[model samples]
Target: MAACQTEKEEINFPKTDLSNMPMIPKPLKTIPTGSAFGLDAGTAIYTSTTDPAFEKVGRFLSENIKSKTGLELGVNSSSEAKLERLIYINQSDSVDLETPESYQLYIKKDSILLNAKTAAGAFRGIQTLQQLIPTKSNDTLTDHPLWVIPSGKITDAPKYGYRSSMLDVARHFFTVDEVKKYIDALAYYKFNTLHLHLSDDQGWRIEIKSWPKLTEVGGASEVGGGEGGFYTQEEYKDIVAYAADRHITVVPEIDMPGHTNSASLSYPFLHYAGAETPRVRTDMKVGYSSFDAQKDTVYSFLDDVIGEIAAISPGPYFHIGGDESHVTKKSDYILFVEKVEKIVQKHNKRMVGWDEIAQADIDSKSIVQLWNSADNALKAADNGSKLIVSPAKKAYLDMKYDSISEFGLHWAGYIPVDVGYNWDPETYVEGISKENILGIEAPLWSETISNGTELEYLAFPRIIGYAELGWSPSDHLDWEDYKVRLAAQVPYLEAMQINYYPSKLVDWNKE
Candidate 1:
């Protein structure tokens, strides 16, 4: 596919003045049109079959059409009835789809039907439909503002299954509402996974009923000391629910052994010697305090904490952070891995840890989020452990955009938006197969980020690129084309009232 294609050839819609303006330009040929099943201009009816979930999707479509074009869309859930212009969703089709920008829309003149194997697919289709809506004044272009149902077939699926982005809530706390907003934005861009780094030396975000001090005392900190706040169980639940509705899985990370300052402060017994400790420093850095993995009590405590998190999180995976554990005594690290593996199995959830955890004789069921280097990723892949490539040199968004910026931290290399977009995951680890590759994730560490605005400034434009790299086929990604699409997305961000650094304005040559 060429880098660009005209919209008229792809989808037949009345060309309006606004259509030529490039604000809503035609999709690139590489951008698969989910309309593979076929579509017709005639009105279509939709109905649900054995699966009631289809009925919910139908209702959502009806509501969206009503709001966007003031058109009343009819919906029926009966399986026996044959209706023209209709759709059927059965129980057998409830599979998950995690594409970056592909949707499945089935339509015919007599009836139109659409079914997403998963809610994520359904949401992506909705976003595509939104793009089809005319951006110009409805009254000037036509008598009715309703969009013409473009004819075509779309049987689309994502190239990657793990389209994700990681957020560091520990360094700088964001409000529950702000977290929801980020979820909405991620979902809007077709990213399916939201990795929340909930714990670090800086702070512990989630509430633990048994260990109340984890939140009560660890949640808030002194003003100037860089101590931040934490989220209550109620607030965390609310955020999870909100993400669920948007078809985005919330993967919570509780860094262990190393990033356990907050955990130690809350439950002194979790420390190496079971010595009581007060609230720790807010500086975002590697933690020295670690749980005594050799101790049985430590595993019990982890089981309890994981149990609390699992109860609230509906996702199938749990992140038992095993990264940067400098305090791990050689024997203790091995025992810790053994115990953690058992606990992960007990919970019936796959364990995900940083690449460093691979050294602890962990099970293959564990998924490794490779950060330090490709060597770790290769080792994990060789051991049959799935890996999410997030090498710090290329995928870490927390690094300053340039070396000149005095963002407080100097250790992490400066990386700009272009540098992030230029990173190709397939090439990151030489021998790793794409099948073994789970997906790509951009980690926004919060050493210098103090608040939500700073977080947005660093995450936005770069995140969009990562989303594309994770979603689109590697051969199809074009930096120039992405910049075009990214330019169009800026206004949407503005309308949404987000503070993100503009990629176009950032002078990559300055360094």
Candidate 2:
């Protein structure tokens, strides 16, 4: 055990003025060495009297240090009055030391304490620390680089609690390793939520113990194009663990009440009786096969499926996809809502559905992901449901960033990087208050994206812009400033060999 220091030391840094920016703080004089890894490798020392949330921070540091530094770390909590090399989270204080929504990192000699008023802030602080830790390439710096902690403190919290990015693994399945890489990328950008569209008309991407055919048969494809396979239960679990380690929640979406072609193909009864056995539709557009939401068997089957998925995902929300259920009889929509509500309540989980699902007489607790228009978000909020704004006109990343017709699906107008960066959700809905907005999401529907590289190409640059929109205050995000920051991020992405869409060349000097 390391001896604890018992004195308060006044800390000071050079007050040299650099950029006159009010927000940017002067760099700290000293930098802390060593790294904290995954959850199990503890770092922070606290008293048993420490808040549970503070303990959570310690667990996070331990886990993070092991994963990032490949070193095991331990935490010791004490009531002794001392100043040490580590950060000390003073839970006794009511004022928040760091922003709850964005990332923060603090460093001190011998010990460091990552403190946040809220659990989310603690999580974000750890994320920033992960970014600060030197990777293999950064280990050989010429000057002993100081871990300059950003000053002027941010009382930061998320603009939207549900800043999400949805990945369509059903269109073209990504391997577990590829999925883990994607999770890492999302974490880097401060996107806390990852929606895995695991099942669709094309294929079922998870194994079901009760229904082996769902994976054994539906996971395979007869059509050679867009033909990829499902992940085994073990692989899916590993992916979940990986995302958990990154503090990113994985919300598995099983398209139902529609988009059940794959599941229907596995079991004929899942669809309307005597309907033709569903097959993979090669057309990129959404297909119509849906589970008979009115059937008792349908509810039973879904309960089993959702139970399996919920067991693996630690997220509090589940996506019971209710989009484009063309075959859902008017009566079935009502019944579908009832059945979904029962399942969600039974599992102690919240449900999230596309805007159309709002039509069903569902509980207000279900989150509405407004995709078609801002009006949908307004309506959802008015109806007392939380909202995630992902309007097709502005936030949809699947749309091409340029006028190149060859790029995007082309239903909505092409939206380039600047267009994405320029979108203001606060202004999109005229009378609705921003308080109703739970957060923003940029969906990457994989109808056209067939491989990891294509997925990367379409996702980045645009995704970065979305992250800023989600994290930074709306007034703080400027197109010119964002472009500058974005340019710096390109080399980092390249160093990681990330495939991404190139931003259109712009002459910023003229502006």
Candidate 3:
């Protein structure tokens, strides 16, 4: 994982078909050594008897398959007879395989079997099965489609426990259904975490029953000076459920201390007289408005907000955004973050914040999201805080892929698809080793993205890059081989109607 193993020796993937197939986020291990498995009218899926949890997984896969192939593939428990043209899933009691997400898949001529320790691992295997479906003519998925796939044995598990993606909705609000679309796409790439940036200077996107004005006033405008919207408690709960059903955890973020213009405008008591008069910012400027950290009422307001957010979001980690606070005094910033951490802990939620939290008296058990210097990340890791590496230079999907790009910013430099795919999370920083690392995250700040189409255009291809980096082993990553597989994914993406920026580095016609 050292700088993606120096591009001179790019990694390779399993050699099976020279035809169309989605290739990014290569599995941990794959070997094509058996006869082809045909997905036809007779295919059936089976679940584990020991764990009834897989019944849901079986139904999910069966529905997707039915939609794509127009085949009513049967789904039954292990008690049923093992039939030909089958996809089998079972739980293993083996002790050496400690990770719950670890799984082994064997695709043979007549039967494809997947074995995992838990239902979660089995669900990850289902993602791979979808990828195995042919990409060519993917738009015309039918019973007669070429359902043949090369027989292979794949032993796979994620390299990082917290493979994540962040969506900044406050800068440009997205509806609940749109957010669900984003979650489904990321989950397909093996990303397990969904960090929702729900608050910023432009908008506040979640309801607070105690403070009804937060959404009524603060959620009334976005960055472009348009009417904004906020999610009701029930809507937010549905989002959480949708994400959990797909094996993705929702990490709701309430950017506080800084990025509080919307809040200050709603509740004037949170206003600092020294700062600019509170107003919803239409421009993408940072570090201006801040909460009155010293005011006891401000803490009381945050207490209510945090309690409400934590109640809806069942995820263990609650993200208290503590980044970019230029207007707030250093002492005030520290005190603000310190109080936020205690509030989060009191609600029985683990705290997560930007790397700047390392500068304050933050909780050691909290997870620090690194978006700036490696020195800051190393410092946080050295102090016993887990690190979520998302250096803006390489990991920021919001950055344009090149200078000529029509969408996204270039402050982090143009992250070409190769540049995005080549940097490994494990070795991106010199001093912060895997032990210090909690996982990897790619943040898509929606400064330029206003809709799901724009978000997909910025995310794809690069998002898949981060997905592979977090799942595939360090030694297994190779840019040269990966580029080929990466190009192959174009057809599948097109079939799904994903609006992706086609990089010149890739030969799309090759697929």
Candidate 4:
């Protein structure tokens, strides 16, 4: 039997309308053509240029298509002739796009064209295209004769350049493969940044070669007193490379002053004199342990740590966890932050810290992440530092869906799916406007969750809406319309086997 019908053959496509297709973080503009594109074995993916960037995305599209529909679509880079039933990926020569991640997608009965100014843009466009593929035909094991994509034209770009998700690996170390899986989920939602909370009171998840004891002693235990783990330098690089291939930047964070029990346990010198000698902590309590802010050696130690991590990390920013220094005096805390800022600058990376860092005289190029304090956020804006808003009530993933939910905390109160999506970052704090904002980040602190399933349960559904909040324009967001779009994502999530919360607020679709 023939795998696909020829151009001369008559193949009737099902009537399709994409006017209200469930696309998270809806595109800036969409026009449904009331037609559809049918995929078969004969379709080929074509790259318009020889650039590896375009080729990479082309191959990615082909691979994803094959995985979903049991179709063998070959990627052709040398093709110059127009081809029927082809997916053409191109890098446009335009400098006027809103951001480097901007893209345009046009789909017709015979072909799909994707145009972007950069590879990141092409990657995002492909994600939107993936959403257009009907879930009924998305089976890899079974031989599916046909797959369909709704015909449409979409022009899209993110409202914020830094749509990020933070994974806290310090409290409970997640393996590289586990982290990569998290990265895949982030990329599928068009998130561009993965902020790794690498160190905290419970554990240290990255190896420091100069100070072997840091990981040897500090990384040995986790929140439940279980034998924890750490990633070697080579392993860290591999994770970074994997994320880069998906167009996501890896932002490494090492919390300091406070959240230093794991570090101080490895070296006694880090603790203040006459203070209780820090021991390994498995409990969830915070703001107890702190680095010796009065010591010059503490600054010298940070120089080596920052230099080593920055050398391997290619990203432009370094996050120093500057929150929760309850034990340290306010004056000393401010001085510690100021000195650490210089050390971070010396490593050629812009400094990033929690909102408390605003108390220090830091550089304007630095970024302040707002987690619990709006006053600190306002202070950061006053100091001219950019802010990444992750308000606890709205963006904290570890917050339980409700009192009955399993595997999450309730200190920040229950953050149901709707609550996570209904807030605005630009005006969340009065003094912090659009100009002083970098973007929004949903931080998944791993205090309660231990494995991938638990992580997915807490992150999905809500994270999907967070992605929309970060990408879609503020004026265009409507809760009623978005819940429907989010409900449409049920099939994709089910197909991917993501263990998402079945929130009662959304009337999810059945597969």
Write down the lDDT of every candidate, Cα atoms only: 0.67, 0.67, 0.83, 0.87
Q: Which stretches of candidate 3 lie over 4 Å from their true place?
A: 1-22, 77-83, 135-146, 509-511
Over all chains combined, what TM-score does candidate 1 have? 0.82
lDDT string for model 3 (197-288, tens) is 99999999999999999999999989778788899899999999999998889999999788899999999999877678897688999988
Best by TM-score: 4
Instruction: List candidate 1 segments past 4 Å from native.
Output: 1-49, 59-103, 106-115, 146-155, 222-227, 273-279, 403-410, 505-511
Model 2 lDDT per residue over 67-175, tens place = 6556445555454233233545434344544345433344433444554565556666565554444333222211222232323322344566667788888877788
The TM-scores of all predictions, comma-separated, are 0.82, 0.79, 0.92, 0.95
Model 4 over residues 321-413: C-alpha lDDT tens digits?
A: 998888888888999999999999999999999999998889999999999899999888988889999999889999999999988998989
Q: By the lDDT metric, which is better: model 1 or model 3?
A: 3
Best by lDDT: 4
lDDT computed for candidate 4: 0.87
What is the C-alpha RMSD, rounded to one decimal, of candidate 4? 3.0
**lDDT value for candidate 1?**
0.67
Global lDDT of model 3: 0.83
